[model samples]
Target: MAVRILHTADWHIGQTINGWDRTFEHAFFFKELKEIVVREAVDAVLISGDVFDNQNPSAEGMRMLFHALADLRRARPHLTTVMTAGNHDPAGRLEAPGILLEEIGVSAVGMILQKDGGLDLSRHLVPLKNAEGVIEAYCLALPFPRASDLPTLTGESAKEAGSPIVRAVADLYQRAVSGAREQIGDAPLVAMGHLHVSGGDESEASERRILIGGEHAVPATVFDESLAYVALGHLHKPQRVGRDTVRYSGSPFPLSVSELNYKHGVDIIELDGDSYSYERHALTRPVPFYRLKGKDGLLVAEVEGALEALELDADLPVEQQPFVHVDLRRQTSALGLRAEVDQILSRYPVRDTGVSIVSAKEEGQAAPSEIVSLKKLEEIKPLDLFYTAFEKEHGEGPEARHLELFHSVLAEID
Candidate 1:
């Protein structure tokens, strides 16, 4: 039996803390998802992890996701939706009221699997039989690995071996996959997990700090032959791990400008019997926001040229204007920068971007003396300046002393 599925992950709902509005992007993401399901005639949809930005999403965000899921269920009654919880989710929120998800025809594998010690692996072995009685495939839902859950790795002093965290995580994943295999029977299993795995090409979104010998990531080799394909999460860039069998289906929206160049989309996997092949579906973003670094005159002209030229591409819409990241390198005061950007923002009517003033000093200029003046203050980093000003405004006790030390260290010409 052929198993046609939509592979997607990292919805990251309620992720509006950054400069961009995630709500808008996610709204479009689901719309595109809906279109994909209808166009592809999908059998099931697999969301690897990070469904919600945080456990407690805003009421509006919840409503938006709920409505989208509801629409999917209504459109495709036979389509099974499989999802798992990522590190961002609160375990309790996904675990409670599990029955409600069944009614909606969305099989969420998050907190459900982790409840009552571990997953009832047997339940997943049963192949998903369609309306035509054709057995599609088996889905093994594993929640985000936690050190406390793996009984085999029990030891308070495990860290003495050096890189204890990496060993412990590997052990947990091995055990989990082993248990999943027993229940897998003869069905082609697709394991949906929410931990960082090795072998993918790292882009801007892939810029994250993984601890040394810690739970930074797991290798795709862990999945091995047991899983025909491993749908992964945590990293926001779509990439292949190991033998292309394991893949991280990156976030739908450009969360940061770092991800501006990444092709955000879903995977359309076509399964023939036990073997499968897949292709990427490119998503359409509203605007192409970019960071242009140059002098003042050059920066303004480039933005203007881009704005005027963008309209020629019929696929690109006016509202989808490129958000400008103005990095002007010139000798300008903070007040002057504020005024310049403000003028541009008003004239261009660009509501979705920002600017940064990076002053460029000529080489071999004499460095300033110890007594820091208001004019020299502009040379210091914005973060340093803010903290120093904060200390000056509010009498320094503990935090002020720390800020002063930071300011002094930063001011030194290294």
Candidate 2:
């Protein structure tokens, strides 16, 4: 049976922690995704995981997601959609098989596995059917690998670098794949899962996992050769791990400035019996949120040059404005650093941007009061100083009540 599919992941809707309005970016992501699905005539769409940044998304977030999915299913009723939960996700809640979603022909293998890593396969394996409703393939749904799942492997905890999480995770994945294959039988099997497959790109969100020791990174080989293609997720960069057979569709949008240079989009995979080929559908290139630091005059010159060069790529629409993070370095004696940045923001069509000023001191110049006269404000709380000077000189009413309460609490401890 010939199979055509679109692979994509990490649509963190309503994610505003990073300063950009993920809501707006998410809408753009789906708009582009729909075009890919329609353009490729996909038989299925696989979302590896992290559909929402948090377990409970905002109302607008949920509405946007449901509307998009409903629209896609409405346009293509026969399209089989599959998704799983990632480490960033609350797996048990997100992975549970939902009847409402299933009714719409969307099969979610979210958080159904127990903490011990055991899965009930009765509902996990979906026999893929053609547009004519004939069985054509099979799907094995695997959620993110958890430490609880591998009781047999002895190892150190994530805090201990020498611990066995790596070995244990690798073994668990081996067992899961083996078991899933046995349950799947002879049909051309496709494994859709939410885990890092060793080679995909890591953004700020994923960086926390890689840095702290508790996470599992699996080798691509854990997936058996019997599988036609392993649709993996968690990483934000579209990548082929060890071999082209195991690939990540990557995040649909840039998750952070760390992923600024990454090519954002989905993957179109064509499965022909024993072989498969894939192509990347480039979504719009996002504006790089930058942090630039230099002397005042040089910083302004560079900012001007950067603005002149900010042209939209062919994949991106012109109206999609870019964001920037600008920093200025100036001698303490040098003046008007704030004014210069304000001037830049006023002149540019920057969607979201911030400029920071760095103070430099010459050998004989007196230090600025903010830096050198720290003794004058040493008795004051940093919050109070900032608020009293800048925040409308807040009157000592309800606003100052909380400040007093905070001071009282600290005073008791002192």
Candidate 3:
């Protein structure tokens, strides 16, 4: 019998989108995720990492995780699950309930605990049991490796190591894999990790750098052919690294405005004896991310026109409203662009996540565009921004009357 396993990661629970709590979106995704598990008759579920958005997650976030696990256990008592911690999680805290959660068919590995002066390989080994209580496979669960968790090396063997961090990481994996092989018998061993692989694409705005300069990403070679599959996390984009067997199951929902174009989903691995096949199932994003744009640099008139033309469902629930980001071309000024975008978006049933200004076309100065989020709008001076806006709109210098009118408005507001 082929055992089905669901591979997922980067939950980023308790994450907020521009200060808006996304509990509704998460709840919606979980509802669909649970359905997928039950419908697929999944025998095991592997959550690679990023269980929480931050190290000190809110109590509500804690409830969300516990409830999701308890609900899954109730739905499928025979199901097996293994979850690890990411950089965003407090590893030790996640492992606090491990002893109690193990009885409920869930194994949570927060960190690679060192015991008795040697690495504790006991907690890392998890037997993947299929429905009807048959051991079909084994999972070597590894979490986000802290610098402190990595083994130190010295002597001639250490001299050949290209980078200390990379060498330590590779050795840790080899040790864990070697230990898992000792007990898996005829079962094909699978592994899970919450770190960046050499070739995996990253969402710059959402994913945090695992290493200081991101110079020590583990290579795919570290995962040898002995493992049937390797479920990875950290990177938000779903992709195969080195081979199809090594993959990342991206986050279920978009975590940042930069992820607007990303297709978020989960992966399913069908394990049969020693061989397995993989498939990706895209999840339905409950709250859609809609890009609101204008032709070329948004001319003063065109920007307002685009906002009025934007169609949004008036009766839509606030919690289910789509996220909006305005793509404005950089001209000479940002004086009223952000304010206008904010004012117009407020009338529609949508959440304004960000306003991105594209770099202006200037001869010989070839420069990269700066994405100015609304959060940083306060740093800009009002008059300076208005002057830039004035020049961009009219294609000429601002008149003294324009400045006088601007000050008059400011005085009126004051």
* Cα lDDT tens digits for candidate 1, 279-362: 899898855566555433234445556445444344444445456555554433455664555465555544434455443244
Rank by lDDT, highest first: 3, 1, 2
Which pairs clash (backbone N, Cα, C closer than 3 Å) in model 3?
Answer: 333-388, 333-389, 335-385
Model 1 collision count: 0
Query: Residue-pair clashes per candidate, as listed?
Result: 0, 8, 3
By TM-score, the candidates rank as: 3, 1, 2
- In terms of lDDT, the poorest run of 10 residues in model 2 is 369-378
After TM-score superposition, the amount by which residue 6's alpha carbon in candidate 3 deviates from its true location, in angstroms, is 0.2
Query: Could you give me the TM-score of model 2 versus the true structure?
Result: 0.72
Predicted candidate 3 versus true structure: per-residue lDDT over 167-278, tens digit per residue: 7788888888776776665578888988888988888667745642244387898886888999998999889999989998988888887787888889999998967888
On a 0 to 1 TM-score scale, where does candidate 3 land against the true structure?
A: 0.86
TM-score of each: 0.74, 0.72, 0.86
